[model samples]
Target: MGKIPKNRDEALWTLAEWNLSKPEWQHFYSPQLKSDMMIRIAKEWKLDGVMLHYNRGCEGLSLGIAENRLAIAKAGIPVMTFEGNMGDEREFDEARTMDRIDAFMETMGLKRELLHA
Candidate 1:
């Protein structure tokens, strides 16, 4: 009645088409694609480390994230993950995220240098 068609028959067909067309975790997908993409990006940019934000709010985007982390590590890239919600501020923990980031930087042999005037 709101977004769908007023007719039940038409609504059924529209909903089916929408569900079938979704490329999310509902469909057959290869995690290797995301793994390969991360690997290529790291190599291309010569990145010292990769930080993956596990957005709790977005299930579709985070589907292959764990596998991607493993694959990136296997490919000899330093990677780390932090969990938080991208859309909701209440779901994010600033202190915990900062701690994980600090650990990641330390693992990468990175240290903050104090700026002097």
Candidate 2:
């Protein structure tokens, strides 16, 4: 869901069909396609890092996330993953997610800052 299409073909398929490689991941998002897209976008935008939300009920989408994180880290930016479920409030863990987020920010040398001073 985070990757930006690199070309017209990708844009069309990614947006319209989700371009996912297999059927295990979510019905909408393609884990394989998204992994590739994220790697590219992180490089293109010079991003500081990436975050992966592995839904508890969506094993299909979360299956290859570890590999995705590895490939993304190869680009020299940190990648963080946390647990949660889509549309299921009971599966969400606020404290754990927050901890991972904090760790990611610390790894990236980021700190809370005022948007407008």
Candidate 3:
């Protein structure tokens, strides 16, 4: 109780670090960390591209996705995003998603080869 913020800014900053509740702080923290993580994972895996799903159903997880995509692309990683809903099929467009995925692959100079399992 004694370890409390003196004012609103301090309080919100603390909360932002903990839960990312403040919008402005979120803008700063989310993009940087998310981008760094994506970049790290891409490097570690020697990935050719990254795919991001903008889930319309979960606003919190979707936050700063556009910024993340931009950052990942800036780091010389091919990145693409498709908007969809995890819990609701109505918000998902399968054809569009597939087309976008194909485009992404094309941009990476990849050609699909069908394999028989």
Point to the candidate with the largest lDDT. Answer: 3
Report lDDT per candidate: 0.78, 0.72, 0.81
lDDT by residue (tens digit), candidate 1, 47-99: 99899989888877788889989999999999999998888989988999887
Clashing pairs in 3: none
TM-score of each: 0.71, 0.64, 0.71
On TM-score, the stronger of 1 and 2 is: 1
Q: Compute the lDDT for candidate 2.
A: 0.72
CA shift of 28, model 3, Å: 10
Kindly report which residue pairs in candidate 1 clash with one another.
Answer: none
